[model samples]
Structures are given as C-alpha cells and as structure tokens.
Target: MQIRTNALVSSVKNFLIEVGGIIDFTVLVFKQFFKKPREHKEMIKQAYYAGNKTFPLIAITGFIMGLVLTLQSRPVLVEFGAESLLPGMISVSIIREIGPVITALLCAGKIGSGYGAEIGSMRVTEQIDAMEVSGINPVSYIVASRIMATTIMVPILVLLADAIAIYGSYVAVNMYSDVNFQLFYNQAYNTLSFKDLIPATFKTIIFGFMIGLIGSYKGYYSKRGTEAVGAAANSAVVTSSLAIFVIDLVVVQVTELF
Candidate 1:
C-alpha cells in the first residue's frame, strides 16, 4: 500500500513538472513573437505547407462525416415526422461543433506529428544547437513560425470543412427524401447565427495554437537520439488530440453559460 501511494505521488509530481515546463516554453515562444526580425517568410511557408498538405484529408473526412451523420439521423427524425428539420440540424451540428473539432483532431494527427518529428530530428542532429551557435533564435524561427501558421490556417480549414460538410449533408438528405438545393440551402443558412459561427471559429484558433505548441514543445525538448524523434512524434499526436477534446469541453461549458 505504501509503495502504491509513493508511485502515484511520483506520477503526479512528474505530471506537474511537465505541465510547468510547457508553460515556461509557451511563455518563451510568445516572447519571441515580439522580437525583431520576425520570421514572416518562414511562417508563410509553414502556413502554406500546413494547408496544402492537410486540405485533401480534411475534404474527404468532412464529406464522409456529414454523409454518415445524415444517413444515420434521417431514419430517427423521419420516425418522429420531423424530416423537415434535417438540413437545419446538420448545419448547426456540423458548423457549431463537429466540423471544428474534427478538423482540429485531424490536424493534431497530421500537422502536429509532422512538426514534432521534424523538430525532434533537428534536435537529435544538433541542428538546433548549431543554430544557437550561429546566433539564430531557434524559438523565433522554428517554434513561433509553426504556432503562428497553425493559428492562422486552422480557422480557415474549419470554415472550408464546414462548407463541404454541409454540402455532403445535402447529398445525404436527398438520398431518401427530396430536398431541393435552394430549399436545403435556405434552411441550413437560416439556422446558423453569429453566435454559433464566431465561437466555433474562435475555438478552432485556440485548437490550432495548442496543437502547434504541444507539438513543438515535445520536439524541442526530446532526448537526443533517433528513438526520441519517434517518441516525440507519437507523444505530440496523443497530447494534441487529448488537448483538443479538453479545450472543446471547456469551451462548450463556458459558452453554455453565456
């Protein structure tokens, strides 16, 4: 019993230390943002890579998500004789919650892992150390660029995903019932408000920041070895994915109070 209690205490201590380290690292990266010689070129390059690489996957997933959701929901709504609410229902769900969260998770897997592996390899190879020797700020050039890129690109990706998902929902709606394009469009559009759109988009930006931060942190602090690179990549994906769900839950609970 004493051993078990000590083990649990050790685990909690380690967890707290990790959290504190991340907080310090985050503050350091944020400070770099205001420093001179801003990495606009690197940031733009990272942003372009982020969007270009992730767009295809996001499109496919968004379409399938909407399609499956509508197909599953149609029967239940039909039984209740509320099939007319299908378009509005899909739009609200896809826009306000599902789309942003799914897109963020997808990015947490793809972009987050990519950043971790790339930076971890650099760390292992002493590239980061070489940069420091050359008087280049690794935090500014590497970490800041990535976090900013994700912060800007994620909301845009969420918007695109929301649009594509709505269209997919339309296709599913017409699978069994006749939903005209104009009528479906109107219903979906009318149901959405600034309240839903603004908060969802804002949440995605936070998601993007967390994904980038966690990925970069894992990579930057990884042990100096080849195996550490892989470990960093894996942990980045897991951490970012978990963070997305936690942030979503907190945001939802807070939004409900308003």
Candidate 2:
C-alpha cells in the first residue's frame, strides 16, 4: 500500500512539474516576444530553414497521408455504398484532424528538434553567453524568433499540406472510382463548414506554440555537455508531441461543447 501511494505521489509530482515547465516556458517566450524585436535577419533565416526547407518533406508526408487514408477508407465507405462521400469525408478528416495533427507532429520532429539542438549547442558552446556579453538579449533573439517562426510557419505548412493531401486524395479516388477534380473539390468544400475550418486552424497555432516552447525551453536550459544537446533534442520532440495530443484533446472537447 505504501509503495502504491508513493508511486502515485511521484506521478502526480512529475505531472505538476511538467505543467509548470510548460507554463513558465510560455510566459518567458511571450515576454521576450514583446520585450524587443531582435535578430530579424537570423529570424528570417530560421524561418526559411524551418519553413521553406521543410516544404518537400511536409508535402510528401501529406501526399502519402491522403493517399493512404483514401485507399484505406474506400472499403469501409463502399460497404455502406456511400462511396460518393469519400471526398467529403477525406476533406473533413484531413482539415479537421489529420492534417493539423500530422503536420504538427512532423514539425515537432523537424523544427522542434532543430531548435533544441541549435540552442543546446549554443548554450553548450557559450555562444549564448557571448551574445549576452555583447549586450544582445539572447532570449529576444533566439527564443522569440524561433517561437515566431514556428507559430507562423506551421500554419502555412499545414495549409500547403491540406492542399497536397487533397491532390493525393484525387489520385486515390481515381484509382478505383471516377472523380473529377471539380466534382471532388465541390463535394469536399460543401461538407466543410467554417466551424470545422476555424477551430482546426486555431488549434494548430497552439500546436505550433507548444512545439516551439518545449523545444526552446529544453534547449535553453540544457546542461552537461555534448550529450545534453542530443538529450534536449530528443526530449523536446517527445514532450512537444505529448503536448500536442493534450492540447488537441482540450481543443476538440471545447469545440464540441461550444
């Protein structure tokens, strides 16, 4: 009984610590964001690296996601003889759930890990200290830029992913059925209301913020030596992925209630 009680207490304590870390990291990023804008050039570079360079990977992943989803859903839909609903169903699922979730996960793997490693390395190498000694606010320059870049870029990438996914769905539809481009899109857009689009889009911003926050927090506070960099990167991805699901559950529940 005592052992079980201790395990429960430990679990609760760890949960609280993680929650506190998330809140503190969010506050710090926002504070730095409004404090003063610094490192515009570096921010832009990071944006390109995080956004533009990631386009191909995002596109391919989205394409495969759509293709696989459509192919897999076909038999189920056909069983109901509701094959015509494929476009609408795929669009709704992609836009409302799969697209944002998948895109965020991918971004967490790419941008989150990158931010963790970059900042972890900087911290380890004393580069962050050098910037401070030079009168540069590392928080504003490093943390703020990464936060902004992720917040902005994830949505754009999601939008693009949705588009590509639709195209992939089109191909998948044509595989065993007949669906013209116009007719497919018409069915898709018809079933998708503003309610679905708005909530899904907004939730992605939260996803972006979480990814950036966790990544930056882990990287910024990393200790040890070179090994810590890898650990930071790994932890950032794991924590941010978990955060994504937690936030997604909350957003979905709230959206449903409203």
Candidate 3:
C-alpha cells in the first residue's frame, strides 16, 4: 500500500511539472510574439517552409486518400441503392473528420520532426547560447517565428487538402459512374453545413499550434550530444501526434455538445 501510494504521488508530481513547463514555455513564446519589433523576415521564411514546401506532400496524400475512401466506400454505399449519396457522404467524411485529422497527423510527423531536429541540433551544438551571447534572442528568433508560421500555414494546408481530396473523390465517382463536376459538387456542397467546416478548421488551427509548440519546446530544451538531437525529434513527433489525437477527441466531444 505504501509503495502504491508513493508511485501515485510520483505520477501526480510529474504531471504537475509537465503542466508547469508548458505554461512557462507558453509565457515565453507570447513575450516573443508581442515584442516591440516583430521578426517578419524569419516568420515569412518559416511560413514558406511550413506551408509551401509541405504542399506537395499534403496534396499527394490527400488525393490518394480521397480516391481510396471513395472506392472503398462504393460497394457499401451502392449496396443499398444509395449511390446518389456518394458525393455528400464523401464530402462530410473528408471535411468533418478525415481532412483535418490526416493533415494534422502528417504535419506532426514531417514538420514536428524537422523543427525538433533543427533546434535540438542548435541546442546540442551551443549555437543557441552563441546567439544569446551575440545579442540575438534565440527563443524569439527560433520558437516564435516557427510557431507563427505553423499557426498560419496548417489551416491553409487543411483547406487545400480538403479541396484536393474532394476533387479526387470526384474523379473516383466519375470513373465508376456518369457524374458531372457541377452535379457532383452540388450534392457535396449541399450536405456540408457550417458546423462541419468551422469545427474542423478550428481544430486544425489548434493542432498546428500544438505541433509547433511541442516541437520547439522539445528541440530548444534538448539534452546535450548528437543522440539527444534524434531523441528530441522523435519525442516531438510522438508527443505532437498524441496531442493531436487528444485534442481531436476533446474537440469532437465539445462540438457534439453544441
């Protein structure tokens, strides 16, 4: 009983420590973000890296996912003579669930890992300390800019992914049956309510923020040595992906409440 009690206490203490670290990190990031003169140049460059360079990855996956989803769903949907509902069903699935979740998971793997490795290497190499000695705020220059880029770019990627995915669905549907572009979208658009669009988009924004925050935090505080660099990247991706799943569950619950 005493050992079990001690273990429980240790778990609680660790949880509190983690919560405190996140809070402190958030405070520092806000301080950087609201500094008198913003670092527009770095932020822009990060945005390009986060959004533009990541576009092809997002697009290819989205297109394939849409094609697969439609094809897989066809037999089930057609069995009940519900073929006409294909566009609407696919749209709802893509916009409400698949698009946001898949895009976020992909970003968490790709972008999160990259940020973690880049900053973790800087930390391990003492470049971060050198920047501070040279009078540049490393956290602001590194963390703030990356976070800003992610917060802006992930949503745009989600939007693009949704469109591409729907187009892929259109192609799939047309291959199996005679469906015109206008008619396919007419059914699709009619089924998508503001509820689906707003919640999904909002959650992706939160996912983006968490992805950036987790990556930068892990990287900036990485342990010494090269192995720590890999550890940071791995932890960043794993932790960000878990956070995305958790946030998604909470969002789904809250949105259902509405």
Candidate 4:
C-alpha cells in the first residue's frame, strides 16, 4: 500500500512539474511574439502546412462524419416522425460541436506530430542551439510562428470542415427523400445563430493554440537523440488530443452559462 501510494504521488508530482514547465515555455513564446523582427515568412509557411496540407484529410473526414451521422440518425428521427428536423439537427451538431472537435483532433494528430518531429529533429541536430549561438531566438522564429500558424489556421479549417460536412449531410438527405438543396440550406441556416457559430469558432482558436503550444513544447524540450524525436512526436499527439477534449469541455460549460 505504501509503495502504491508513493508511486501515485510521484506521478502526480512529475505531472505538475511538467505542467509548470509548459506554462513557463508558453510565457517565453509569448514574450518572443512581440519582439522585433517578426517571423512573418515562417509563420506563413507554417500556416500553409497547417491549413492547406491538412485540408484533404479534413475534407474526407468531415464528409464521412456528416454522411454517417445523418444516415444513422435519420432512421431514428424518421421513426419518431421528426424527419423534417434532420437538416437542423445535423447542422446544429456538426457546426456547434462535431466539426470543430474533429478538425482540432485531426490537427492534433497531424500538425502536432509534425511540429514535434520537425523540432525534435532540429534539437537532435543541434540546430536550435546553433540558432541561439547565432543570435537568433528559437522561441521567436520557431515556436511563436508555429503557434500563430495553428491559431489562425485551425479555426479556418474548422469552418471549412463545417461547410463541407453540411454539404455532405445534404447529400445524405437526398439519398432518401428528394429534398431540395434550397430547402435544406434554408432549414440548416435558419437553425444556426451567431451564438452557435461564434462560440464554436472561438473554442477552435483555443484548440489550435493548445495543439501548437503542446507540440512545440514537447519538441523544444525533447531529449537529444533520434529515439527522442519519435517519442516527442508521439507525446505531442497524445497530449494535444487530451488538451483538445479538456478545452472543449471547459468551453462548452462556460458557453452554457452565457
């Protein structure tokens, strides 16, 4: 019993220590964000990777999400004679929650792992150290730019995914009844308000920030080795995914109160 207790305590202590380290790292990145010689070109490059490179996967995922959801839910709603509400139901679900969450999780897996491996390799190669010795701020040029890229691109990706998902839902709806595009569009549009869109988009920005920050953090502090690069990539994916769910829960609860 004592051994188990000690193990648990040690684990918690290490976790908290790592959390504190992440906070400090985040502060350093933020401080560098405002410093001179803004890394606009790097930021844009990161954004392109985060957004354009990730879009095809998101497009397929979003379409499947909407199609599967509509197909699964349609039968139940049809039984309850609520089939008319299908468009609104799907719109609310995809836009208000599913779209953002799915996009963020995908980004966490792809962009987060990419960031970690990329930076971890740099660390292993001593590139970051070389940059520091050359009077270059790694935090500013690398971390801040990547974080900003994720912050800007993830939300845009989420929005694009939401649109694609809705179109896919419309396609699914047509598989059964001959619902007109205009009618489906009206139904979906009417059900959505600024309240739904704004909060969802806001949470996605937070999701993006977390994904980038956690990935960068893992890579930036990774142990110097080839094995450590893989470990950092895996750790970044796991941590960023967990952070997305936690942040989504908090955002939902806070949004409910407003």
Candidate 5:
C-alpha cells in the first residue's frame, strides 16, 4: 500500500513539474511574440507550410465530415418528420463545436509533430547552441515563427473548414430534399449568431498557439539524444491533443456563462 501511494505521488509531482515548465516556456514565447518578429521571410514560409499546405487535408476532411454528419443526422431528424431543419442543425453543430475542434486536433497531429521533430533534431545536433553563439535568438526565430504561423493560420483554416463543411452539408441536403442554395445558406447562417462564431474562432486561435508552443517547448528543451527527437514528436502530438480537449472544455464553459 505504501509503495503504490509513493508511485502515485511521484507521478503527480512529475506532471506538475512539466506543467510549470510549459508555463514558463509559454511566457518566454509571448515576450518574443510581441516584439517585431524576426525572420520575416521565415514566418511567411512557416505560414505557408502550416496554413496553405493544410488546405487540401482540411477541405477533404470537412467535406466528408459535413456529408457524413448530414446523412447520419438526417435519418434521426426524419423520424420526427423534421428533415427541413437539417441545414440549420448541421450548420450549428459544425460551426459551434465540431469544426474548430476537428481542425485543431488535425493540426495538433500534423503541425505539432513536425515542429517537435524539427526542433528536437536541431537541439540534439547543437544547432540551437550554434545560433546562440552567433548572438541569435533561437527561441524567437524558430519557436515564435511556428507559434505565430499556427496562431494566425489555424484560425484561417478553421474558417475555411467551417465554410467548406457547410458546402458539404448543402450537397448532402440536396440529395434528399432539394434546397435552394441561397435558402440553404440563409438558414445555415440564420441559426449562427456572433455568440457562436466569435467564441469558436477565438478558441481556435488559442488552440493554435497552445499546439505550437507545446511542440516548440518539447523540441527546444529536448535531451541530447537521437531518440529524443522521436520522443519529442510523439509527446508533442499527445500533449497538444490533450490540451485541445482541455481548452475546449474551458471555452465551452466560458461561452455558456456569456
């Protein structure tokens, strides 16, 4: 019994240490975030990779999500003979909850892992040290670029995904009962207020920042081993993914109070 208790306490201690370190790392990044960002061209390149490169994946996923959701929900709504409400219902769901969370999680997997591995490899190889020797800020150049890229791009991607998902729903709705394009769009937007849109978009920006920050933190402080590179990447995905759901819960709770 004592042994088990000690193990549990040890686990909690390690977890808290990790949380404290991440908080400090985030603060450092924020300090750099406000300054005139370095590597203007690098930020653009990172943005392209994080945002533009992600379009195809998001587009296809959004379409499938909309179509599948509509098809699945239609049968249930139809049971009540309320199939007409499909557009508004789906739009509400995709916009208010589904869209942002899905997009952020996808980014957590793809972008987060990439950041960790790239940064971790640099850390293990002494590249980050070399930058410091040259009087360069590795944290700002690499970490800030990624955090800002993801911070800026993820929201844009979420917007695009939300619109594309609505389009997919339109296609699905038409397959069952014809809906005029304008009417379908109008109904979709009608159910959405500033309350839904603003909070959802805002949370996604935070989500993006968290993903990039966590990934960068793991990589930036990685241990000096080749194996640490892969560990960083894996931990990036797991940690950022968990962070998404946690932030999502808080956002939802805060939105409810509004």
Candidate 6:
C-alpha cells in the first residue's frame, strides 16, 4: 500500500513538473517574441534550416501516409460498396486530422528532438553563456526564431502535405479502380467545407507552438553534461507528442461544443 501511494505521488509530481515546465517555456518564448528583434540573419538561417530543409522528409512521409491510408481503407470501403467515397473520405481524414497531426508528430520527432539536442548541447558546452557574455540575447536568437519558424512553417507544410496526400490517394485509388484526375479531385473537394479546413489549420498552429515550446524548454533548461542533451531530446519528443494529443482532445471537444 505504501509503495503504491509513493508511486502515485511520484507520477503526480512528475506531471506537475511537466506542466510547470510547459508554462514557463511558453512565457519565455512569448517574452522573447515581444522583445526587440535581434539576430535577423541567424533567425532567417534557422528558419531555412528548420523549415525549407524539412520539406523532403515531410513530403515523403505525407505521400506514404496517404497511400497507406487509402490502401488500407479500400477493403473496408469496398465491403460497404462505398469505394466511390474514397477520395472524399480520405481527403476529410487527411485535411481534418491525419495531415496536420501526422505532420506535427513527424516534426516533433525530427525538429523537436533536433532543437532540444542542439540547444542542450550548447547549454552543456556553455555556448549559451558565451552568447550572453558577447552581449547577445540567446533567448531571442534561439527560442524566438525557432518558435516563429515552426509557427510559420508548420501550416505551410500541412497544406503541402494535404495536397501530396490527396495525390497519393489518387494513386492508391487507381490501383483498384479507375478515377479520372478531375473527377477524383471534384469528389474530394465537394465534401470539404471551410468548417473542416479552418479548424484543422488552426489546431496545427497550436501543435507547432507546443512542439517548439517543449523542445526549446527542455534544451534551454537542460542540466548535467553531454548526457543531458540526449535526455532533453528524448523528453522533448515524448512530452511534445503528449502535448499534441492533449491539445487535440481539448480542441476537438471545444469544436464539438461550438
């Protein structure tokens, strides 16, 4: 009984710590965002690195996701003789849920972890200290830029992912049935409304914020030595993934209530 109680207390303590960390990180990012903008060159370079360079991975992942979703969904749809709805169903799922969520998860694994390790390493090596000594605002240069870059780039990536996923769905559709390009797209678009598009896109912005916030927070506060860098990276991914789900739940509930 004592052991179980101790375990429960530990879990709660860990949860609270994570929540506090998230809040602190968010405050720091926002504070930095509103501060005098410095390091434009560094910020731009980071944006290109974080955003442009991530495109290939995002595209490939998006393609495979659509293809697999369609391929797997076919038999189920066929059973209902609703294969005609393939494009529409896939499109809704992709745009409304899969595209943004999957893209964010991928980003969490790739970009989130990258940010954590990179910054954590800097912290471990006292590069951050050197920056302060050199009269550089490390928060604005590192955290603000990353947060801004993720915010700006994630939505764009989701849009591209949506398009590529649709194309992939088209290919998957053709494997078992014939669908003209125009007709397929028409069917797909006919089912989508501003309602689905707006909410999904909005949620993605939150997802991006969470990813950047968590990654930057872990890295910024990391302790110990080089090993802390790896730990920060790992924790950032794990926590950001959880944050995505938690935020999604709330978003969905709120959307439904509205």
Q: What are the RMSDs of all candidates, in order?
A: 1.0, 1.7, 1.7, 0.8, 1.1, 1.4
Ranking by TM-score: 4, 1, 5, 6, 3, 2
Give every collision pair in model 5.
none
lDDT of 6 by residue, 1-258 (tens): 999999999999998987887787788778877778665777678678778888899999999999999999999999999999999999999999999999999889988999999999999999999999998888898888887888777788888999999999999999988889999999999999988899899999998888888888899989969899999999999988988899888998888776
TM-score versus the correct structure, for each prediction: 0.98, 0.94, 0.95, 0.98, 0.97, 0.95
Candidate 5 TM-score over all chains jointly: 0.97
lDDT of 3 by residue, 1-258 (tens): 999999999999987986688779989998888895577899999999999999999999999989999999999989999998999999999999999999998998989999999999999999999999999999889999999899889999999999999999999998889998999999999999999999999999999998999999989989999999999999999989999999999999999999
RMSD after Cα superposition, model 2? 1.7
| Best-fitting candidate, scored by lDDT | 4
Q: Which stretches of candidate 3 lie over 4 Å from their true place?
A: 1-12
Worst-scoring 10-residue span by lDDT in model 6: 37-46
lDDT of 3: 0.93
Q: Please give the lDDT score at residue 112 for candidate 5.
A: 93
lDDT of 3 at 165: 98
Give stretches of model 5 more than 4 Å off. Answer: none
In the range 1-258, model 4's lDDT, one tens digit per residue, is: 999999999999999998999999989888888888799999999999999999999999999999999999999999999998999999999999999999999999999999999999999999999999999989989999999999999999999999999999999999999999999999998989988999999999999999999999999999988999999999999999999999999999999999
Residue pairs in steric clash, candidate 3?
Answer: none
8: Cα error in model 5, Å: 1.4
Global local distance difference test of model 6? 0.89
Better of 1 and 2 by lDDT: 1
Clash counts for the predictions, in order = 0, 0, 0, 0, 0, 0
